[model samples]
Target chain A: MTSPAPLVVGFVAATVLALTAACLLGSTPMGVERVLAALIGSGDAGDRLVVWEIRFPRALAAFLAGSALGASGAALQGLLRNPLAEPGVLGVSATASLAATFFLYYGFVSVAAWGLPVAAIAGALAATALIAFAAVHTRSIITLILIGIGIASFAGAAMSLLMNLAPHPYALSDMINWMLGSVANRSLDDIALAAPFLLCGLVVLYGTRRGLAALTLGEEAAAGVGLNLPRQRLATVLGAGLSTGASVALAGAIGFVGIVAPHIVRPLVAHDPARSLVPSALLAGLLLVLADIGVRLIQSEQELRLGVVAALVGAPVFVWIAVRRQAARD
Target chain B: MTELIATGLTLRVGRATLVDGVSFCLRPGELVALLGPNGAGKSSLLRASLGLQKRSGGTATLGGRDSERLNPVTRARLVSYLPQIRSIAWPNVVRDVVALGRFSHGAAIGTLREADRAAVERALDACDLLHLANRRCDTLSGGELARLHCARAFAAEAPLLLADEPVGGLDPFHQFRVMDITRAFVGRGGGALVVLHDVALAARYAHRLLWMKDGRIVAHGTPDQTLTAERLAAIYGVRACVDGLRVALEGAA
Candidate 1:
């Protein structure tokens, strides 16, 4: 019998194909031909505006954000050396969420629209900086996660305080919408705001690809091989946080993409932590795109937020992964 | 021949000094074993040499250069290191893990320079891991995992190889295999500085011995000079007597 590599390759290739298909068909129910016609630039004005102005931009945001989260998750899992670590668990997501929340409550950008997520992205960087301080000093995954949890708790309290003192319905509604997360009615501006930081984060992470591999030999071995631990730690935190922050700002707190992307891509790459970064990014983009599409496919008249669907899929999948891991250990 | 000199090196961790006033030098192609029990400063001293730990006093020089002057990439090109036990967070394949050794030498992550691929292949072939190259590292047995680590370190192509317990948990056959490979590495214009626990293995493989007790070197010389019965009894609190074909360590072995 042949090895399992070919089977995994087939599965990944199929997933990519399906993700592309979903992206094409994702803006449907507005009209299939309208999406097709819009692509060809000959659609009716109403359908054209609907496709171009709304769904297309939102889809791109979800795709890019999910990809960033996926790549970041894989890298953090490798750098921290823990299977359970994610943007959300490590407080990277919470830090970003609080940043977004503050933006919502205080209107940090003082704009009519699109500034909330921008401020939220900045918040992600701030939180990442604090967490990196703890992670970089010593190469302990447990300490980093613990520090992230502390940051998350602190951010959570701050979030509660903001919610309590919200001045009006708009603030409360915006905060609630953000906390729950949605990609609804997002503009190209949202996409533009989050993209550069995510790309930069990706570049930073790519540079550490070798250093991260050296790390697999343990921090000491990594140092023996001439890896700069402080620099690697900085790259991991900032890269992961920037991508995560931008995504969270635009999409609101989408859970499990980080965990799921790396979890899937690692096995696909036969568990090579270094190469796992790129595949994780690809798979995360695909997973989020598919999930976003799933939301539209099951669209209800009452409008089910994408976060609810991700939770429905993401939470149980995460729990199953945990159970399987525990069973394997046993 | 390249020279590694550590003079009056003092490494302190927190409030505790791990290695105090330790001075040693290693020449090219020599197989020197650092002997000490667990919690001794063997690992700490090696780390200080590699700049992984801060030395409280003294300095280390490699090839007549201030060793710390070598940047991360340059340092990696000079000295290859292997730790005792490492945590594997991802399920990276053995081949890829071995290839990671070439990272510092590569132009970028995706582009493996011609020399990088050659080194990776050489490493895999040297460690007899060619068949298992495609296997996931996490799926390998303990002995197999250790062998893969050897391949990774060898792939680094450094002049000096520092290994902390490189074959600690392996079975006898694998231990022999690992030591033989290590010796082979040294024979190929390189030096090996190994930290070993088994006195017999140290006796069998090492060309020189640096016997450490507590935080200081009790003795440093050829095995015949340093592995005296009196010194063994003093450092290990176990008498060593070799009669004809039989060897004893006061039941310590």
Candidate 2:
């Protein structure tokens, strides 16, 4: 069958808004004519810097972060075979938080400029190793989720300790900013930093679509159908972990996109797990872009973290859908 | 010949030995019914025969190759199996679930061949599940879900199929339809070994019966020879009789 109508509409909206958001959220806001002139490369140097050096990066980060989280959620759910499985539940985001905390607060690294995202990625990989180690007993999705929770909690405790013991005001602020998340001061360098990891994560997630489809039959059954269990598990963990790490590194752990986007797109694909990835990615891009736009329109003097805003909107919707689904199961 | 033959096969689960020294030979174009009381090792034997359970002794051979030694993809092409426990919170449509049987043959698993689609369609049609193709399996009745699985098993188009009580949850109509589809498989030169509870169904559909008791084959022959009242009573501790078309049983063990 052809792609669903909503998917088509979603792509259109995402494309339009991506360009518009690119033009708007720069170093400085410009009028429509300057924005167009900037778009066509005929604008003033300041307008060009505002568009290229500042706004474009933030907009790109929003798109990638949302896509990564969405794909991560979908892949984790498929791997764990639980709808409740999110990036945080998989321990990736929590590990990133812990690593970011350590980099910003405790250590004054030589490459301190790149410490936040680097440490976050290291944390993500560590969490992945821990989860992977713990997940080896029996092939229970519940077991994977439980292991994820343990890692996340452990990372959370470590992060708190680091925050309390931070060296100075600059360190404390850095930890808090990394934890809360923001696209506010992102530059082309920040986007470049996150792009490879997020893009690679998306590629890995895309590669596993069919294997994930086989996963719906359960692990051993998927293996019997000629999928190597270890390989699938590795790809799944890496994909989800990279996405979570990238999101935490650039946007600082935007929650709910991972949970919400997959749930929404999976149904339209008729629960075809293979098709869940790309759709989940696009839908997530739409979601974060809209949420970022909402944050702007609210006009708060105090900056709002993307994660808190998502939780505010996502938790209720998630609960309602979950309750409805649980009712259906019964 | 695409026959499934097992010799001196033994399967153990933990400390419990499920099948000990089981031997059977099932030719293509025939259905062999495995009959046993609960926990008498019918499922274990099927699992062993399908290479889902690693045999502790001897070997199960399909198409002249040791079943366990066949490459995974080749083995998948040679045999398909359906376990008793099926669904687990999957919202996949019935048809997509069936198409998964082609995972081995497809290009890296996402693409399905024209032949694969044809097989899936034929399997779905054979199981009379065309109307429910797009319906989510979670919405299906137990019987319908069982049929959906049967359709998948059929879609696999393996020469040898090991099915554990395939018609267990089906209503009589769908039960017969599943049995008919299974029968059609054998008719088309495929071999099927089915574990079944319904004695009459075994008698009506299977060309041979292997009555298992306490993890051993107590009797193996035609239905009329092996399903005698004495053998039935010995295996199941129940009184059983065949009066004309009716095989009556007063269940105990």
Candidate 3:
């Protein structure tokens, strides 16, 4: 019942502002005019190199990854019918991280031109396939979620095992940095690598709107209303897997944006699962852009990770929403 | 012609027979009440009929096509279902929740054409939910939520309805109102299969009664034929006094 148009416009404006800040407030600060001029390839050579080579790619990567996570989160929450459900709930991010860590642990990063992201994406798709297979055999959505949790835990342990036996300290640090997650030094090539997966995932999630809306009435009722539960389940798993997989592949494992973004926008859409998808993506994109900016502005010897910053802000918002929902029930 | 026909329907869950070889026909302009004790497969029968639960052996046909083989949307257009559980995952508005009934018709909530809008409004008016159309489902009382689901089924305008325990939690007035709504739906040349535990109410409104026990229909006929004292004792483990359309449970059998 709530119109998402105004909220969507607001999110777009906020995102554009955040992006501008990201471009202009880096190591060597520049005016708005200088940044715009650089954007158009007419600024000073040094400024153009800084904007196009580094800041622009990183900013775009953050926004794209955030948008993917946000949309995936909304779709997963709708499909699973759980407010806490997110892209990570299905083990896509964890498995992708595990695969990337495996590659980093083995020094396979230099073996191929695009080794890490491809491995991560493959890992994500594998996890999604497993979930989809389980979805077919099981009748309960809760069972599917438990299976996802199982897969994630297994991937987490595997990553720990790999980290525990790192050949050298440098390998260990590389693995840790990936786990901590950041958009620093991301290249346009990286953006291009993850873009197709993200786009495909978002489109797949969009098609699941009707099925997810039917699920709001509960699984049995959803089936009663004529939704093909298995097909919907498969589509949701695939979509979330692709997007979440791509996010991990792009920026290492950024947490909480998926859950927090959709949670923030649910009230604005009057709790309609289908209506929350786009706004959730926009808000999440904005949040990540701002978090990346924070990462840059902080005066620390070691740059802070985007994952760490997001968890710091996101964990509390998750708790607040949970408590408020419980109170309302009471 | 029959709206629904079930033949030798059987359901098994790991060797336990839930719904045994049961068969029945629900014809248009008829209100058939499925009466049984708990765990007698009342809910399972309804679910199995709609292909929500897989049947071990049997067939359920809706509008002359196998229910299981029919596309979900096509099956839904033929039959609408009101499930027993009423909890909504989200606090969606009343109007939007009801509009979900139009899903099979290729209509989504928050976007409806004039004809779909008319059906939604009529359903809301019928269930006395028009006043609460703007209210959130999570804020509604148990009775109001029951009416909301009923309105959703009505809005579908499906020729056959499978309703499970539709009046379980309502007060007397709302209870009768629900029965009246079902009766009105039947009056409009639609068929309905309702699950009800209130024997008196079932007897009062249902033209036919299905007596199920241990996953089988033991007796089925007009209200007068199925509501006998002996049948009540056998089916419900109760000694009942039956007078015309009234059935009083005196004590344990």
Candidate 4:
């Protein structure tokens, strides 16, 4: 197998290219020279304003959200000892979506500017805690996944019910748009609001990486090797929850980047969960940024939703992974 | 040298008593084989001794410290355990997997110090897995994985080893090799308490045999005293002829 240095460098290169593309290709297309000049602070005021204020923050939001999802997914998969375990598929993101939507629809955001994001983060934490609690009681991976699916379905239904009773058509559209997910109209303030939580989550995960590595030996053996199992589980849950919550707040519950990016990078790190964390975060961030670029390039009457495009690309990959996992088991 | 002492250890699951009052001492430089039929609580006893299970009664001590009160890392440094189920969650390389034994010593993945690296290498060499050091654990056969976990325990350099069904999936050669590894460990003044169903192998390698029935110790002594014809019939319900440490089964009792 190849060393991690080249792989990390490759991911960085791809990300730079994608970020450049994200800047250059948009509703108002800018030339390479103009984008370059704008980037270096020598272009027209209008170009500079668009580049620095609008496009950059949106792109950054996409990347940060993707990084959060990717890292959270890797930590979760390591904790559960299942590659298929991810924030979106495990119902955490959906529940966060529901909480954010509830706050928005009920005018909770009017009372406090931080209410929606906090509610989303709390929702994610609650859902993750529920899943972790269930995980302890059951030994079968399939059962745990089914419980996640159940939570997702329930959250989806509740969100639909909220939409059904929405007081106005504009409110309905807003809810629908949020549910589909997009980084459009996102500003630096949104990134600023979510970044601290994301950083905290990543720090926690990084500190607990060794415990995740030990968990590969199975829970009991991990405990036997002197790992405090409860502490490990709590750290993983807190880390994954904070990151997932922040991502949902920033980007509205995009799915599958977590699963796909980690799955792709696992072999590069010799399948060690600890080593896979950073690379997975980088790759997933790149993938989401590229997907956002795709969303911009394809001209639709209304701009395409980033999450819809992501699901279109990622759901099939999810199926492929599940099938391969089953085949491996058989 | 450290010793493990258990007194009146009892484990009950709700209405059912899984492990009745059982007591024994595993001293350094001794290889003790715990023998029992199916569902006789051999696994439970091993877990209880390590404080991995919640015992309903009595106490277990390691080096004069209460087993339940010992810090996890301190307990791990005193004793290493190889469980019955050997499942590796990821496809980590054999060397990386074995190095996990140094977890109590603060060795992180991909960051092994000199002593940790030496211990891992020595364990691999001891288990004859040095040649397969880079292979992914998931690709290993059952016996190989079993031996790999044993090597992990050996890498810990703990004073006492508690292994459940360590030799079960192994072929004759590997089985004897595992027994020899335990014997060598004991010879080095370490202690071992192994759970096994192979009476003959236990009689051959162990300094003492603990015969348990229905979660209680029926007898514990040298092989010569424990492997009698009448005891064999009573414990295993098998009619057999006993000559010294050898038992030749004739039919079912």
Highest DockQ against the true fold, candidate: 3
Off by over 4 Å in 3: A89-91, A109-115, A125-153
The docking category that best describes candidate 1 is: medium
Candidate 4 chain B — worst ten consecutive residues by lDDT sum? B138-147
What lDDT score goes with residue A112 in model 3? 80
Measured by TM-score, the strongest candidate is 4
Tens-digit per-residue lDDT, A129-160, candidate 4: 99999999998989988989998999999999
What local lDDT score does residue B87 receive in model 1, on the 0 to 100 scale? 55
What is the RMSD of candidate 4?
1.7
Q: Top model by lDDT, which number?
A: 4
Docking class of 3: medium
- What lDDT is obtained when candidate 2 is compared to the true structure? 0.77
Please tell me what DockQ candidate 1 reaches.
0.51
Question: How accurate is chain B of model 4, given as a TM-score from 0 to 1?
Answer: 0.97
Of models 2 and 4, which has the larger TM-score? 4
Off by over 4 Å in 4: A1-3, A40-42
Q: What ranking emerges by lDDT with the best candidate at the front?
A: 4, 3, 2, 1
Task: State TM-scores per candidate.
Answer: 0.90, 0.89, 0.95, 0.96
